[model samples]
Target: MHVKDVMTTRVVRISPDNSVRQAARMMFDNNVSGVPVVDDQGQLVGIISEGDLIRRTELCSGTPSPADTGLAPDEIAAAYVKRCSWRVGDAMTPDPVSIDEDASVTRAARIMHERGIKRLPVLRNGELVGIISRWDLLQAVLSARQDDLPAGDDAIRRSVLARLGDNTGLEGLNVTATVSDGIVHLWGNVETAGCRRAARLLAENVRGVRGVVEHFPDPYPR
Candidate 1:
């Protein structure tokens, strides 16, 4: 499914001019770990997380001793920006990673995994539309499973094939599918681990799929 289907539209954002204390309070009151930092025109410029706030000098005894950091003079100057920064723009990570709202949730998951980020801002035409977090993806998985499978095993099988075929990686893969009593059985050969995961997620995302059993044999040896 697309990010728009699962992303949270009621996003809380902070301005670049806002104070770190204000940003921290906003996150605490909203119970979020991070927030998008926007410009005066509401354009996304950066992100401020709990990690950023916790590193502030006010919370960490003003500044680290030169001996403690052992940093070069230039490095020390750069570190000072982080230590002394009180405004969101100064402390926030600039040019943060973002995703299009119409992109697949799998793509979102992959980006978050590669970046080691907790959340992603969903944008459309260069404007913030919503936000998706690890929690939101988890919720999507749980909710997708709870949905009732479509009536008839044939219908289920067709749906499974359709979903897999929709993915370009699985488009030419030799995949077979069968469904009985809402449980899907997938037997296939894929070129890569990503394709294997693609097959599984495609099946799992289909409504009325109670369970999926994959028997995919990878062609490449580890």
Candidate 2:
């Protein structure tokens, strides 16, 4: 399955103007590592991860002052007590690595591997629609193990359609599906590139789908 197939739709978000403390609090309360940053009009602007926050702390104190050049690293870190106030624009990784909803899961995995990112932003028409993580892909693998796995492409097609029906989110997805070997092929239309990806993730979660190949119509408005 692809990143879109397994990504959660109920995404947590933060505004670019939101304080770092506020973003950190949201992550803490939601038990998430980061959030997508948006604008007043709800556009995907950037992403802030736990790693970014940690980097803030490191940079805030890790810088060696002229007077502290002789100090040990631990002592320097200890002496650098106050966190420098920063904006989302300052702390965020702008234009993060992302996937279109209509790309293959293999491609998403490959991009993540190449970029060394743990999660990928699912984009639709150049907007942040959702995020997918390593955990989501792992879940796709586990979800495919239940029941008697389909033995061939036709059976896999039937199994995938059944899953789309079962997944109401995917049921509303305007896409067609085909199968070859164990891979599911997706075509048709969606509201956004994000929805396309969501459709694929749904297919991945089905018990018989080994992988997904998405080639959907561009849902972006001209």
Candidate 3:
């Protein structure tokens, strides 16, 4: 699926001129963790997340003085900005990671994971069009899963074992399958990637099977 299929189009965005306090209030009111900061042209410029607001001077006291930390002037200045900045332009993370609206869901997932971020701003023609969150991706997966009919455990076990024995051509392989609550647990050793994929496919295609749990052994080093 594409990001556009799952992204929330009615995004809550803020201008760079907005106060940090106002941004935090918006996030709390909307129950969102972050908000994209936009320019006058409505182009995405940055993002202010909860992480950005957590260190505000208003929230905490007893911070070490710049002299006590023995930090360089530049480092001290940067710290002061993070603690004292009130506007989104100064407090937000600039040039935040974003994905195209037409990008694949897999791409969005990868980017979010690699960056340790929970959301991705979806852009079209360099304009913020939507936002995709981890929750949205999970919902898409669950929705797809709901379309599959549940198969009986006994039927799943028998059919999956049969397919593995006949179709996989993994001679002398000892693959066993057990099913409970429509989930198949496959345990075995496969010599090749194709064999592993075939085994999973067989189990997944079986009627009444809700999911596959593979417990294949680690392959010995060649």
Candidate 4:
């Protein structure tokens, strides 16, 4: 599978100048843990997460230091709060590691692992196309399993489950597939509208998927 096959294209974005509080609100409202920081032209510049915002609060600072590191929580909080006052451009990881849409899902997974990151922005023709998270990789892997196994009509059902587990980390996606001559009928609730789209795309990408009967609900069950 390709990175584009599982990325969330309709991204939630915030301006660099947006306050940490505002960013947090956006994340909460959208039920997203992070938002891409973008410029006026919607160019992806960085990313901000709940951890970044929480780090700025005096009361919500880090844990108590170990004996080896003699640092007060307040001291760490003070520094973080100070940086939070600046625009995201000053604090966010500038020039984030990104992947091309055509890149394989395995490559995307490798990049995330190497960077110790959960997400990666997808680029196409030098422009932002989408973003893929570790969840996406998981879903892709699940989808690949169904194609690898050969079985009866019930085979597609297990295939869909595998797809759900692999392509997305969303565990509750209820999958029911009816395979007749390798044609798949898919039904399920995915984590997000993006995930629903990804599920269908992966089904199509799989070999012997004659057609997909999609009944995936948007804004999947939490």
lDDT of 3 by residue, 24-57 (tens): 9999999999999999999999999999888777
Off by over 4 Å in 4: 58-82, 145-222
**Residue 191 lDDT, candidate 4, scale 0-100:** 45
| Candidate 2 wrongly placed segments (more than 4 Å) | 57-83, 145-222
Q: What is the lDDT of residue 212 in candidate 2?
A: 92
| Candidate 3, poorest ten consecutive residues by summed lDDT | 59-68
Residue-level lDDT of model 4, residues 2-82, one tens digit each, is 788888888887788877677777889998877788888777788887656655534445343233255577765555544
- The per-model lDDT (C-alpha) reads 0.85, 0.74, 0.85, 0.70
TM-score per model over all chains:
0.68, 0.55, 0.66, 0.55
Global lDDT of model 4: 0.70
Report how far residue 1 has shifted in candidate 4, in Å: 1.7
TM-score winner between 3 and 4, please give it: 3
Clashes of each: 1, 6, 4, 11
Superposed by TM-score, candidate 1 places the C-alpha of residue 81 at a distance from the truth, in angstroms, of 0.8
